[model samples]
Target chain A: MVRSGPYDLNVHCIPESGDTIEEVVAVARRLGYSGIAITNPDSMKQLPFSGNVEGFDILSGVEIRADNASKLHGIVGKYRNKVDIIAVSGGSESINRAAVENPGVDLLVNLNIAQDSGFNHVLAKEASENRVAISFDLGDLIHLKGGSRVQAVTNCRKNLLLIRKYNVPYVLTSNARSCFDMRAPRELAALAALFGMSGEEAMAGLTTIPHSIIARSRPPAGYISEGVQLVYNEADTGNIDEGDR
Target chain B: MKLLPPTLRARTRYLAFEVISQDPVRREDLIRELFSSAGSLLGDVGASECAIRLLAFEGSTGVIRCAHDRTDRTRAVLASISTVKGTRVIIHVLGISGTVRGATIKYLAGVDVFNPKDSHI
Candidate 1:
């Protein structure tokens, strides 16, 4: 049996605004989120609070927008360690350069603009070359659908195939503007289903992949302690009775 | 101006207006015109027209309030003002009470409230 893992991934954290770092941590805890990507534009400084939440982990990251491929290439090459996830804010050229230059950073590819610039092919190529993971945004997924939810699902399925084919890493995240807009785990799973994801695949998008990204972004001390060991044991033995513990 | 609808009992009403005239000064002129127009409506009812007051200009939207009794007149004045300058008007009538005020105060106390016109409620 193919084992699907937990979902752990998120994007965006605007700390410069009045929003407190604690509030962001609280929201992640309430939602059963395992990972969070702290993304403010060009701001790579550690958040005022520790990235480690009470129950979840945080990945320090940023979403940067460059004017062109060359500029993006320069930024990624220069500050790869400064960010955990390098999301190209917009522009296909920037994304392409990011994929090529900072091969380690997880690429949160916006499918809407990427497809327009024929960057998806290059994105897929780079993912394979660098062993870097990728995730297509639902906003772009929605935009590509052009108001038709069904079409959006079909497009997402095709996009997933490309990810699988290229062996690019992938995850799921709601591009929420406010705390009220964040989705619960079950809701995110349901959304993934619309993209032709199986229950296990959907679960992984929300859990394991996100966890992996967070792990790579920030290596927290004692992260693989007893709790994580217990989880691993449960996965191995199919005795998830203590999974919630 | 008509009377407040029974549905809007005990509600605080906010009047919103947009500038339509191409002239740069016309927008400010229209705002002044609206204040005067509101005064006239209150005068017709024999109520204290002085109570009808301009509160503040919230971005492109304006806020005016009186005791809830003149809601209809407020709406009418806003509509008439729209007609005079060919600008569009949006009237947001909200039911404000202890519960609403508490929620508003709690949510707004720390946050910088961007007067987005639509979020007044």
Candidate 2:
């Protein structure tokens, strides 16, 4: 948490994916990443890694996959307090809209699978207000080839335009399933450039946005909400901001 | 045939990279995949402009030479390469240098020194 890290916010590890969490963390550390979140899809049974790994931050996260909007809300509430971050797997139009509109969601992933940019002006505006980050999976650029690759790139370009227009927060993730699937921050930035994202913007997505998402999940002792918090004086009792409450 | 002057030649940058795979990868297989990756990603003309060449390969580590201005393109080319001859591989770039010796010494020789775990965040 001390580092303004080049963190990969969305990564899948053992039980859900091929590699174990230790293997994934070792590879990430070797590649110079300060931290990574192990976000296995919620539909799958997840084996929690409770103990901390020294010298590296492993933020526990859940990728909630819901068939409908109401189901999405229920899953978010169930896992909200259990994990450091919550991501919604986006595909259908309903799921994408639900994810963006929900304040509990920290990330909206896999929008590339949708027919078009499932994200649009309205969704972007909602996401901006909700502080939900749109995650662009660079793994699509690597794993997909031929026509699909072109389509994924095109979709990302369109999504990026909307994100920029609305000033929405965004993060870049490899969506890695294994140790080999993970990539360095620079390489991810290069892959990002193929879809018209500048290096600076990609770096911010990799470092700044993800860091902020993690920070937001864990506020200070007296924190209530954005811009306002509880205050306590030595001689007096603590007072919560009624407006924020 | 006459050699081109230094100023007329394309400035070269050496990229030091390590290959991570489940199986041992052959240098020949790596070379073939590198070119094909560059070709598929950047197309024929773009690949030719980058002037990519594998300078050296030993075990899992290697140094590649490309036009200095096309480092990002070259990086994309490397990143796009996920497999070689049915084996899944990830080419992780360690560092880049203006000279082959510098790349070898800085990245290949002293990899432990480059470990980010000990570095200030």
Which is the leading candidate under lDDT?
Answer: 2
lDDT of 1 by residue, B1-121 (tens): 8988969755454433222222222446555766655544334453353244555444333445555554444443443332334433222222222333442444223433222221211
Query: lDDT of all the models against the reference?
Result: 0.50, 0.86
CA RMSD, predictions in order: 15.4, 4.2
What local lDDT score does residue B96 receive in model 1, on the 0 to 100 scale?
25
Q: How accurate is candidate 1 locally (lDDT)?
A: 0.50
**What lDDT tens digits, residue by residue, belong to model 2 across residues A1-245?**
43666989899987777777777887788788988888998988876753346778888899988999889998999999888889999988889899988899999998888558678899999999999999999898898888888889999999999999999999999999877788899999998888789999999999988888988887656677778755555347556555874
Q: Number of clashes in every candidate structure?
A: 10, 0
Docking quality of model 1: it rates as: incorrect
Interface RMSD of 2: 5.5
Candidate 1 — which pairs collide?
Answer: A6-A207, A6-A208, A7-A206, A7-A207, A7-A208, A8-A206, A8-A207, A8-A210, A133-A169, A134-A169
Stretches of candidate 1 exceeding 4 Å from the true structure: A1-8, A15-19, A43-49, A97-101, A113-119, A139-155, A219-245, B1-121
